[model samples]
Target: MGPSRHDQLTIGELSARSGLATSALRYYEELGLIHSERTAGGQRRFARQALRRVAFVRAAQRVGLSLEEAGAALAGLPVDRSPTATEWSRVARTWQSRIDEQIADLERLRDHLTGCIGCGCLSLGTCALYNPHDIQGTDGPGARKLLPRHSRTA
Candidate 1:
């Protein structure tokens, strides 16, 4: 055997090596985040490179990136081959702005909470902090009324 032919791994082996559950691997495949081939018995077989890809996806999630964003970031990788350091760096750079924005939002929320804890505004229903209309549209996801996730129906 030439070089022991380590090109592919069964789904179970991939799961063990990547430290991910087989269901999560399947979910990732379903979400277009990973790829696999089927054997004659219809079992999934993944490329060995998928180990690194799975690790990257988990790391991205740990950093609070949604699966959609992670998928987009990972899409830049070439499926035909494993990613190089340069490729990984390029993908990581794409997240810089998102990370910065999250940090800024967290800081703003922290300051708001700290500033409001001792303020008399908490006693007044008309205060921005206590009024839904006043505070709801002032920050990130809810900056605009009727955000997609917050849509109201008649």
Candidate 2:
């Protein structure tokens, strides 16, 4: 007989429902982003709440959060049940600054794309004009001007 709605899901079942590969699910489990129990035969079994957790992780990724960050957010949620609306809202509020930083970074990229690639590669003559003898390189590695303002070194 098929498992009931309240039954735990096998890895394949979770993968199919979540639209993630089993390998990815394994990775998430390894990272503590989601969790599963072991069957007597050592197969993984995930609570149905794992679906909501997986969705939460995907939503976090859509906002440009790293897996570590998503895991941290998930840590705020209840492990035994789906989060209440208030609980979800509280967790989501913590992401605002990160999302704002991403928005600002994208805006900076969009504003600069026409002028400088900002990799400090100095390949373009225009880079010479903006970067001036690769001065941005001293500001620390990576596309300095493309980085969010607070992330840039003085």
Candidate 3:
């Protein structure tokens, strides 16, 4: 038999349970981060599994993954069923380095917050010594010195 009504949640129910706005749920469906079906009345109904998927997406966001990245990770899971612990671990492992990089970037920003950002703003009196007449502007736009080292071109 097809899934019973109990096995599926109306958009309103899902929104209430997931703590996400119905509009956000629709957006997530559009982004392919979650899926839903239509009832005879054309209202969206989501499988209970969508709750888990929504939670996973929220967790990914907390770790700084973009929606695109979270969608990609979700795509790796089995579409026929929820992912096993091992499957979840496998996908999560790929984000470890990315999370680490974000941590490093935060630490770097914290350490440098009191100093010149080298954006050629020259707002700080100390910029005269570090940037020296906005010389860092010669490199490129943006905060040249404050940007991650890997992002600096010259």
Candidate 4:
């Protein structure tokens, strides 16, 4: 049988099982995203439940959340008890809007990519973006105005 809640894992064990480096795990604790019990020798001991916390942190990161944002989500869970499925569901749902917005942004970028953004033309050389000496090109290379309308600036 696997280790029970009574059998806490050392930092290294938690790192190995969670696929996070030992330093990352320590940083998580420092950020208050995860917590560990202290041994008499001042070493860290993580409850088995910590694995689930690490998973949540990683998943949050995959969804583009900052460490602080992940910590806020994890904070909703009770520190004294393990997170339940229902609790996880509720917390994860909060990310849906953020994910959808990101998807929409990606779609817009993909659809407009490789097309003349500023000038209406069928060729690249005539486009200011393609001509380095053009006024718009003075800003520098890259999709400068390709950002969202509100986000774009001269």
TM-score of each: 0.70, 0.74, 0.75, 0.68
How many angstroms is residue 10 displaced in model 4 relative to the true structure, after the best TM-score fit?
0.7
Query: Which runs of model 4 end up more than 4 angstroms from their true locations?
Result: 1-6, 116-154
Kindly provide the TM-score of model 3 when superposed on the true structure, using C-alpha atoms.
0.75
Q: Which has the better lDDT: candidate 1, or candidate 3?
A: 3
1-154 per-residue lDDT for model 1 (tens digits): 6223378888889888888899999999999888988878898888777887888799888778988878887888876677789997887776777788889877866766666676644422333433334553344333343233533342
Candidate 2 residue runs with Cα over 4 Å from true position? 1-6, 117-135, 138-154
lDDT of each: 0.73, 0.78, 0.78, 0.74
User: Which portions of model 1 miss their true places by more than 4 Å?
Assistant: 1-6, 119-154
Give me candidate 2's TM-score against the actual structure.
0.74
Worst 10 residues of 2 by lDDT: 121-130
Task: Answer with 3 or 4, whichever has the higher TM-score.
Answer: 3
Deviation from native of the Cα of residue 103 in model 4, angstroms? 0.5
Which candidate number maximizes TM-score? 3
Model 2 clash count equals: 0
10 residues in a row with least lDDT, candidate 1: 123-132
Judged by whole-model lDDT over C-alpha atoms, candidate 4 comes out at 0.74
> What digit string (tens of lDDT, one per residue) describes model 3 on residues 2-117?
99999999999999999999999999999998899998899998999999999989999988999999998888888668788999789778778789998987776565554555
Better of 1 and 2 by lDDT: 2
